[model samples]
Target chain A: MKKITVGFLALLFLMTLGGCKKKEKVKVIPPAEKQVAKTGEEVKEKPIPKPVVQEESIEDMSLEEINKKGYLQRIHFDFDKYNIREDQKPILIKNAEWLKAHPTVKILIEGHCDERGTEEYNLALGEKRAKAVRDFLISLGISPDRIKIVSYGKSRPLDPRHNEEAWAKNRRAEFVIIAK
Target chain B: MRKILIFMFLSLFSFSQQEITIRIKGGIPAIRIAVPPFIVRATTQQAISAAKEIEEAFRADLAFSRVFDPLSRDLIALVKDRNPEKPDLKAWESVGASVVFIGKVEEKGEYLRFVGKLYDARSKNFILGKSFYGKIKYRRLMAHRMGDELLKYFGQVPIFTTKIAFISDRDGNRELYIMDYDGMNQMRLTYTKGMEMLPAWSHNGEMIAYTSFRKGNPDLYIRHIYQGRDELVARGGSNITPDFSPDDKFLLYSSSLPGNYEIYIYNLRTKQRRRLTFSYGSDLTPKWSPDEEKILFSSDRSGSPQLYIMDSDGKNPRRITFQGSYNASPDWAPDGDRIIYVSRVLGRFNLYMLFLSTSQVIKLTSGMAMNENPCFSPDGRHIVFSSNRSGKYQIYIMDYDGKNLRQLTSKGNNLMPSWQKINYRR
Candidate 1:
């Protein structure tokens, strides 16, 4: 009876140790998997799958819904500049691909500016921004006839705050689906 | 020193009899004048009120000229008689005034008659006198006419009869409005729900050409202001910043039709459009030279926006501004000797005047909130621009050399001021 009690105690101790080891393994493996998931998200953010996701979401959604879902991303410009930045190229490519997937769609490109310049000059600058986007899409095999450009200049602002961040956001080109 | 003082006194006395001739010999000092309360010939309250308003309008007009120093009301009250045909010249001269303007208003049924006379205080004789008859509502116009006659006697251009057309968002939408040069008689000229901007008055002051987004696109429009009729001059692409030719036979504008903003001129009679610029960059805000032979416009063809001058035929496009990376909204002076424009320096916009003959640029505004859309007054000696220095965008008028800055607007975002050429016949 004494030997059997000692054996039971030993068995209980071993079982507790095993449970702790399992908990340790769980804690260890999760961070590694989290790292992998983070890297995977970074990989997904590349040019390849972005348009596919955009296309899938855009097909079933209305124009307002698409806009609400942010399927078409607004592209930003530098101060007093209309040239698209290199980092924005991939996004434009994704937009172009999405536009291509929907053959019957028409888009209007609205160019905007921060309230830092004269209204008339900003109008010209905004037009240039819209044209830059349209030209890029055209180069990516999208039809020019499907796109129309308008310059709101500094009249419309995405963010009304008077600061650098707000100005950066205000100076952007936005796409609105006119027809589908 | 006594001898020198005596000699100066003698010289001054020699020219005292010919004050007008002496005033013209050197830089004319602002003439000191007295404008007392006008005499009301009618007994009714409304008639008396109308006379008071006429006097006030006349005083404001003279003050706006910046060439007259109107005596204080306190000084004018010391005069015993304020009659237009009476002996107040001695009282005015005692107050250091060299000229005196006296006026009387009479109510004649539906019309008011205003008679104003300018007197040389030293001569105690009438220098000039004029009478104006107009509807009761045109009392201000009558006063302006009187002021113009006074200005003519001083060899200064009369601007009180001019008008200013500007863009205002007071009605929850940007629209064009015309007001008297002193900001009285504000009238809504365009009811288009969309944005209307960049108003340019025709040379004859009969029409106003502006850019409107009424049809969901920026297009050029010309309206016969008095006739209440408008026509679309250009559409289909971004057409903006329209200016009438000196002869009022053509409209110069900028369009983005060829996938880029370029200057274009459209003939009013034939409706023929001619492209003036073919650069890859944007060219906009074209202003006709006084002679209508050259066009001064802002162009970004050289990688940064700068002022450029091209012939009326769109030939020989040459850059005129090189000091700033951003220079735009060029208005050629009516005298055809200078150009006024806005330039961006250290991220703040300010007005600069370029003397065409010398290619010299002078900064007219400094440390004031962003000043822009500068247009020369009809005389080319003053400029009207919009500034936010007062914490809100308002139209301001300053001398050509940036003196006597006066705010012309106080409500809403008043911008893009276009001074109308005076039509004396009107």
Candidate 2:
């Protein structure tokens, strides 16, 4: 039940945020009243349509709408492992939904490794972790085209201390907005 | 007068102190005592054994242990009236010798003969000496034999003439190449159009094992240079970084067979492949310890890349680097005390060395160009690595201290250098 709720929230959040985007509206108005004809004629008022708000429909809204808003998301793995657990799917799905809502937005998924193995192996391992998240997104009906993934490979850490909690946070995938 | 006396004392103090360096053989100190010449019957074919040349080599080779005590001897006097085949003990004892080395050298037109002997002053018996044969190029072998003689005299193993097989892009692309201890006369052993990279010379040096990315996927292959042929070793997956065991009977490599890169060990004799790492994170680049008891590799189990080491049986895996934000591709030193790796600092890559116990970090290379792959020479006195310092990627050699830089290749962009281990096989 929690997984389904988390997944629904992620889908909704992704739909609303849409990551990163930019837009601007320009307005030009004709002179309120043309100068009255100098030949002793009264000035005349021009009629103008009252400005009305019209919803601007957009097909690709995943990336742009989410740029202004930020998210704090985390995925956990078992000790000495990098696979995303079943408990973390709903959490990730929530973020994916927001991405789908705003197509213009782009996101970066950073994969990390714990401090268990050699540094090189950890780097490659981190890459695999990040790639795992990428594949999951595509599986969730999220287009792979909107996401960029990179592995820190055990270089970056959420906690510097050597302990279970620190490693748990270290073995995670993070999402960041790259463009709007 | 007082000032002069103080000055004399300081001068004597400075002169009394000496700075010396000696080589270690099998991590043990070998003494470097000079052995002079010995006189033998000039007409005999076996006149010279462990001759003067071998004596010098013995002294030098013993110094490798960093534990030799030099005793200067006069070759002319030792051999002037003595026959090395049988020598009087009294003459050598008169010199207050802890040990005495006596040898004879005979010259016959274009041919030569050598006989050598080592005597223990305490036992009054021959400790070492043997006859040998070889040409000028193999003269070093004669010295090495004397080294063996000295070691066996002290109950130690002798290591020389071992082969080192490493990946060199000196010719064009990264390919398997072999060379002597000093990186001299390197021969290109692989001639495939595709890259035969990360060549790890088998512990025996007779076969070179590496990852060939031919056929669009990485595969492990072992080649015996003399026969000009190779054998496939892995079952499937992009197998790379194949490091052989100390006995050359097994190999440790990285494979992505199960949809993610992981570590595996393949027994050469048994033809069985064993998976070593099962973490969800991909594990790659496994290096065997000097004793083949541990494996070192890189992983992203953390958020970023770091260096890690595990046991030969894939147990008790621990992280080795904490200071660096990025560290990978660690090559263990033959002496088993130091590990050289590539560390990324501020978006730039360079070579680094970490002392095992102290973890004292030493940056070996610093330049604008990327200095990624580093390999230690067989003697551990020098290292060769790939660098772009010359505006192009090329192989460069430098002293272990990062001095005396020399460009080994000037053409083509060469990279991914893997130094072959060649200190004991021969």
Residue-wise C-alpha lDDT for candidate 1, range B1-426, written one tens digit per residue:
111111111222232342232221122335889877777888778777888898888988777675687888788778877655575677789888888877889999878999977889988888888999998888888989899888777755577888999998877888999988888898888888998988999878889999898876898889998899998899977998988887788999999888778899999999999998999888899988876689999988888889999899999999989898889888987767789999999888899999877888999999847898999887676799998787767999987768778888877888889999642222
lDDT of 1 by residue, A158-177 (tens): 98666789999999999988
Q: Indicate the worst ten consecutive residues by lDDT in candidate 2 chain B.
A: B1-10
What does DockQ give for each predicted structure? 0.48, 0.19
> Once all C-alphas are superposed, what RMSD does model 1 give against the true structure?
14.1
* TM-score on B-chain, cand. 2: 0.69
Among all windows of ten consecutive residues in candidate 1 chain A, which has the lowest summed lDDT?
A46-55
Over 4 Å off, model 2: A1-180, B1-30, B35-114, B119-126, B135-137, B151-157, B214-216, B235-237, B280-282, B290-293, B333-338, B346-426
Candidate 2 global TM-score: 0.54
Steric clash pairs (candidate 1): none
TM per candidate comes to 0.81, 0.54
